[model samples]
Target: MNLFATFEERVAQALRNLQQAGDLPGDLDISRAVVEPPRDPAHGDLATNAAMVLAKPAGTNPRALAEKIAADLASDPRIVAAEVAGPGFINLRLDPAIYRDMLRAVILLGEEYGRGTGQDTRPVNVEYVSANPTGPMHVGHGRGAVFGDALCALLAFAGHDVSREYYINDAGAQVDVLARSAFLRYREALGEEIGEIPEGLYPGDYLVGVGQQLAQTYGPGLHDHTEAEWLPVVRDAAIEAMMAMIRDDLAALDIRHDVFFSERSLMAGGTDAVAATIADLRARDLIYEGRLPRPKGAPDEDWEDREQTLFRATEFGDDVDRPLLKSDGSYTYFAADIAYHRSKFERGFPVMIDVWGADHGGYVKRMQAAVKAITRGEGALDVKLCQMVRLLRDGEQVKMSKRSGEFVTLREVVDEVGSDAVRFMMLYRKNDAPLDFDLVKVREQSKDNPVFYVQYAHARCHSVARQAAEAFPQADLSPENLATRAAASQTAIDPAELELLRRIAQYPRIVEAAAKAHEPHRIAFFVHEIASLLHQFWAKGKDSTHLRFVNQSDEESSLERLALAYAIRCVIASGLRILGVAAPDEMR
Candidate 1:
């Protein structure tokens, strides 16, 4: 159903014909040859650089090769004309019937039409939004969550065996801080006058419920224990409660991970898994004791000029060696991370993708180095960095300070604007670029709000179908019976409808390219274009009464347009599904 892929195959087959006719060399490599939409619509419906790519390899002039290819391609009924353009490029003008066929393809394939050959069967593990188990997820975490969840769905649609994962940072000092904060709340819940929370402690009222739950379970027994006796009990309770809150926050946005890994479990019960992993690296000569060079453009504080346990990251594309242990014989966070990734490798994930915030850009190389050193470069790890989100309300900056616990939580934002708006806004820009999230703009139902614009396009299509059903009671254009009619309607199409069908036919190619590039924003951009086209097409029908979807006198054209509208709705719904947003059949 992919028109671009179909055209490329047609071009390749034409080239083989040339080879058999003794007009071109047989051994020329055609792998780099590509057929795509022309940059300018004036050029043609499609263009190819096969002649230019094969000319040098075939030891022939590019212009001559292009002319030969163009002549051969023109023989196909689908290609009305092929002309040689600048620097041996072949511009192809497809016959109007080809576009008609494309429209028919959309009607026939419906939602499944755009899914490509994807990963076939490669198992992929995507880990994202692994926020420390200290508090509720904030707006920044929302971007990563939306991006990761969409990516997992995209991969799954592309036929990959995908598993979504979240790694909890439970074995850190932050969790201890959470425990103390929760303990204070627990005391306050038991009718104790636990005064103002001290500085450097969690100050959010979200922990009040956790405290009440602890009081219900332990009553007054927790107050009698010392720090050592109560720390473990309290820490465990706090982490569980925090994770539950986090899960709820994610569920609010329709996001759920298949696995939640705990860092504490990697070394719990005297397992020393981190040390064991380091030993394995050391045995392979990838670990050593060395002093690291001071980081560039960073303040030099406590320049410890002594040898320490280091990983030979340089051998695996790292700029400098990385520390695996601290001076106090404790595992560094990097050490624990390495062990965690190593565990993923052991579990047989050939492809692993980690979605991290932009602030961790520097961490990418070292993490990639660790993966290579552990797997001997057999497996691949791709780290995607999502830049910061700047929240604005009513054109004024929405203030946020994590240290002061005054930041907006993801739950709060979703509650205000709904999950559909939140998810769409997060994906409206490239992950590597900073996003300006305007609460006021996103809430608007106009064209500026992409979520509503796209959703409304879907709703409009259904409205057309409903109108057609009322006009022609025999059509039965309900969602359930629309599929069979769509397939039947693919045999004929108008110019405007065909253009939309061409775009619909490109979905699989778009998904493959976007997923391969690790760019979810492409999906957003595509949805926007689709919405724009649908709106324009609808406006066209409004002007020409003959072009309207429901013609009271003609059942055949009415059925065709109704089926086309149904096809557009299905594709729009599929794209929205990938973004973790709802596609409404009716706009309220």
Candidate 2:
């Protein structure tokens, strides 16, 4: 049950009542009215600006309209009190029974609590972690990977069918280099004396196994041909090995994509989707042969002033037209990407989200423009750019260099702190904000560590549940049984109980907002908020023994508090599941 949604409908009904009584204009547009938590907790439980939004349109003063709305809302049994404050905003105090009902809903729904009702009628394509197949994923890719995965889970929880996708860059010049690097390894596997890797080739020892695999596939005879003759053969082997390694690396972080689309597939198959996409744009007069302006801010020695193939991205709000083919007569990466997104639209995904790196911020408008022009504005694309993540060890920066092949792999980080820590810390900050991931701090059992703090809140609930079970052995405290117990009882809500339930009640709104904004960091923040409340409430038990969840002195109040504890636990567990973090019963 979404308390905010229910109150919003109530507010709308109040406005309709005003219209029916002829106190307000009948033709007022009130769709913008909303109900949300008040700015200050002391003011009221929830607040709304319905009167302020409609006062001018309804030809009435905001205060007068607010008074009428409040009067109408106070008649409802759920809202015990409603008052106008600060010029027109209405503050509402809900009856304690509403908060109790929310807690009961939590125990009843379990993991499904806070799920929104606005189900997505169509499939959504979430393309993320599209790291090139040229090498292993780095710490930078880790942030985007976790964010994308969590965002996908959030959308799925919000009643959407989400498809997690990874676009592999195997058809570019980088894979050719990968193939050559692997050929050197193959020679080494055949007992040849290969010294240090030459420039322009991968130098990591990770390629040693690729070489051994090539040797087994063709024996010593594989070395009989030139790079031009055997390059394709070697490229296929390198791609296969590298992709396998990438899958294993993703699995280390508990991330697995539904599709690993190869760039080569666009041009390699019987149907050339790239050519077809270009033709589609050309037919619509969006494609043309035009010379691009010389790039500024740097001197280019190889700058060639000539006409080339271009797409009119500016027509759809891009900064400038984009090139689809290079001077070397090869299709640019952007061309292939257009075909990839076009494939998404053809497959019936009207909504598409791309998780890209911060460096690709400038690419968003062009991609959005391409989608608008190609799909004729039927498909919408949102690109979420995640900023760089600075990895720190014990408060000192851990330097990384992919050039020197000394970079830390995603697996190494996950192995060091475990996947739960890695996933939670990665999402502790906004996607567009820089995050400093201190390896030592995330594993700390103290309250300063958010992942541990949240997990501990969940663990505390279980501890209390166990105590309750021991305190009352005859009582059936199963989730189903406790929900029935909660449903049958209606007791006064202690301010402490109200605080916890109100925080947990915000979960559905947070999930809906985060899903719409394409931001999973909000979930991390909300989970931490509820976790903080749980911890504070748990601490209250130390000084006030009467406030403890397990009270051997009184079975009825203890059961009620136990049910409340379980509700908090469910919310934390659900939020952590979406964040891809573990809700540990005990922290090791």
Candidate 3:
């Protein structure tokens, strides 16, 4: 059960009861009120701003309204105490039985405990990791890939119908460069001397295989052709090869997109989707012909002052009107991007999310404006910009990969430390914050390594269960049996054990909040906290044998503690699964 949501409903019901009793104004708005854990755990189990939010509307002071609400809530059997603190916040101390019941629920539900039900099921389109199909994915692309994949999993767990999408950027100048580079490799593959890759071309050895494939398929027929005649054939072949390599890299990290939307397809088949989008906007008066002022710090030759077809971006919320067409009459990149997102709206997705790199921070507002303009304000676009990741070994920076000849490849890192470590460390920080990923720190088998620390907690829980089974061979250690026995036992839970239970109860709230905010790092931070608490409790057991999970002389106490450990294992495993990491049963 969602404990916070349950109390939120109870708080709202209290307000309605006051309205019926002629204490609070019936027309007062209660939607603004919220129930959440207090900033200080010492304050209470839960806190609500119901009275504070409703006071002004009811023509009363907040403190005075809080007193009335507290009195009504104190009568609840589940609430042990309801105190009004500071300026009108109502702090509620729930009965310990409430939390004990939550533990029972956790074991009963297992991994599905925190999963949402009957929430906003809107079709959400999450477009992420749209790397250009010109080369193998770099470390920066891996960061975005993991972040997007985790966010999709979080949304799905929160009960949204999410579509994972990758927008292949094949219709650009970069692919042309790739085709030219592959042609050079093709010549080399056919026994021609093409030494020292020219400037402005990809120098990666990865293209050599593409070249070999071309030679094996078309032989020397394309090598003697003109650049214009061979560019398309080579570009298509090169892009296909690059995408296959990219897919292999993504699979190394266990990320798979539901849709691979091709940007080239937007303008393909002689039907220009970009032009259609522009025309649709023109009919809506959201497009015009205008000239933009020279951008600050732009070189004189780079700044064009000619009138051009532009989108009225400022009308929707962008800083200025954006040009949709260049001087050569070709559509701009933004024009094609606008059509791509419009297609998402047309495909019945009113909620769209784009996960981009930090460099695209400035492009966010214009794209949001376009979505609003095209969807007539019915669609909402949320852009999450993930900052770059700096790879380091010990203290010094890691060198570039010889395979890609530019940056460290994603596959290289995954292959080195395993996908679990790569994925967990990638999500251990906020997407907008610059992360310094230390290669040595991630592989360490200590508390300093969060991924190891968290997974070890799961492994430790299994160890406890095995020990308990050996100590009492006749005991039924199954989840259902343990939960039933735990509920019936009269042994009092220690303070540390109760604290651990409280942390486990907060999982559902964390999942829902992280999903709503589009932040997967929150889950990483949360599971680490659970692991820390479990380790602390285990340490206390070492110091005091009475607190141990498996006590041979006290089978009843052992059964209850085993149930608690089972709950912790389930929660940590569930959280790691969402982050695309594994919760190993045993760590060597």
Candidate 4:
């Protein structure tokens, strides 16, 4: 049960009672009213701003309304005390039995405790990690991959039908360069002494495998063909090989996409989806032939002031109209993107989310505008931009990868520290905030590393269970029996234990909030908080004999604490699953 949501319903019922008694207006909008934990724990167990939100609409004094609401809430036995605090907030003190019941609920639900229950199953299309298929994925791409995967898991946990997608940038100029680079390697494989890799071509050794494959399949045959004849044959082979390598890199982190939509597919098969999208916009008067003014930093000679086909993006909240075609009459990248999103809308996904890199921040508004136009305002698009990750080792900047020769490959980092550390650290910070990933720090076994700490919390829970089992060999120590015993026994009187229970109860609320905000980092922060609390409680047990979890003399008290430990373990494990990190039973 969500304590906050339960209390929110109680507040709403109190407001309805006030409306019936004619003390408040019947038509007041209570949508903005919220119930949450009080900022200061000493104030109360729960707090609400119902009075502050509804006072103006009801034409009543906030304090007076708060007093009325408090009185109504105090009538329920579940709420021990409700008092008006500060200007108009209501702080509620719940009976201890409520928390005990919440703990019981956690035990009974297990790993499914915080998951949403079929409330909203809207089809959402999440497109992320659409990195170019020209090279190995770097650490920057890894950030977006983890963030997107975690966000998808968060949404799915919150009852959304999520489809993970990756848009392949295969039809671009970069892939042509990759083709030429591989062709040079193919000639070298055939004993043609091709010198240094020419400028503007990929120099990475990763493409050497593709060259070997081509040489084995059709050795010396491609050498006799014209540039035009060999270009397509080599480009297709190179793209297939690079994508295989990219998939392998992503697999190391346990990331898998449901769909890999190709940009080339939009114009292939004689459909010209980009042209069709532009025509649809033109019919709606959203497209026109217009000339754009010179860009802010463009030189006069370089700037082309000519009439072009443009989308009226400003009509839907973009800063300026966007061009649909280039000067060479080819579809612009934005046009292809618009078509891709239109396809998403056509496939019945009204809610779309795009995870992009930092450099693509400027592209968000136009793409959102295109979605609005394509769906006729029926669709919503949210773009999450992930900032770059700065790799460091012992406060020193790490060098580039020798394989890619440009940046640190995602596979290299994952191989060095393991996927759990990489995934957890990638989400330790907000997506838009810069993150410093210290190689030395994340590997440390101390509490300094969040992944280790959280995983260790799970391990510690198991250790407690093992100790409890050894102490009471014949007792029923299953989760159900322990929960029943704990529910029947006296409530925990320690302030620290109660605080941990309160944090555990907030998991469902956190999951829902993070899902709605498209911020998976909040989950990372919350699990870390739970880990810190668990570690502090364990440390406390060393000094106080009565606070120990597995008491040898009292099986009843040991069962109660074991139940609590199991609850903590379940929460941490569930959270780690969402983050694509493993919650090990032991660190080693």
In the range 264-380, model 2's lDDT, one tens digit per residue, is 888875989999999999999999998878868774332357887989999999877888888888888788889999999998898999999999886788899999988999999
Model 2 Cα RMSD, 1 decimal: 1.8
- Cα deviation of 457 in candidate 1 (Å)? 0.4
lDDT of each: 0.84, 0.88, 0.91, 0.91
Residues 155-207 of candidate 4 have per-residue lDDT tens digits of 99988999999999998888888889999999988988888778888888888
Give each model a TM-score: 0.94, 0.97, 0.98, 0.98
| Model 3: per-residue Cα lDDT over 1-588, one tens digit each | 888889999888888999999998888888998998888888878999988888988899999999999999999999999999989999999987777678788899999989987378779999999999999999899999999999999999988999999999988888999999999999999999998999999999999999999999999999789999999999999999999999999999999999999998898889889989999999988888878888777443323798888899999999778988878988788999999999999998999999999999989999999999999999999999999999999989997899999889999888888899989998999999998888888899999999999999999999999999899999888989887876676677788887888788889999999999999999999999999999999999988988999889999888889999999999999999999999999999
Worst 10 residues of 2 by lDDT: 295-304
- Pitting candidate 1 against candidate 4, the one with the higher lDDT is 4
- Displacement of the residue 237 alpha carbon in candidate 2, Å: 0.7
**What tens digits encode model 1's per-residue C-alpha lDDT throughout 1-588?**
777888899999989999999887888777788988778766878899998889988989999999999999999988888999988999998766665455556666666767766644768999999988888888999999999999988887777788999999998999899999999999999999988889988998888888898899999998999989988899999999889989999999999999999998898897877988999999998888878777668843322567888898899998888888778888888999999999998888978999999988878998998999888887789999998888899889888644336788888889989999999989998898899998899989898789999999999988887788688876666544554455544344566776786677667778888878878788888888988989988889878865777778877777767766777887888888888889898999
Which is better, 2 or 4, measured by lDDT?
4
For model 3, the superposed segments whose C-alpha errors exceed 4 Å read 297-303
Taking the candidates one at a time, how many backbone clashes does each contain? 1, 0, 0, 0
Higher-scoring candidate on TM-score, 1 or 3: 3
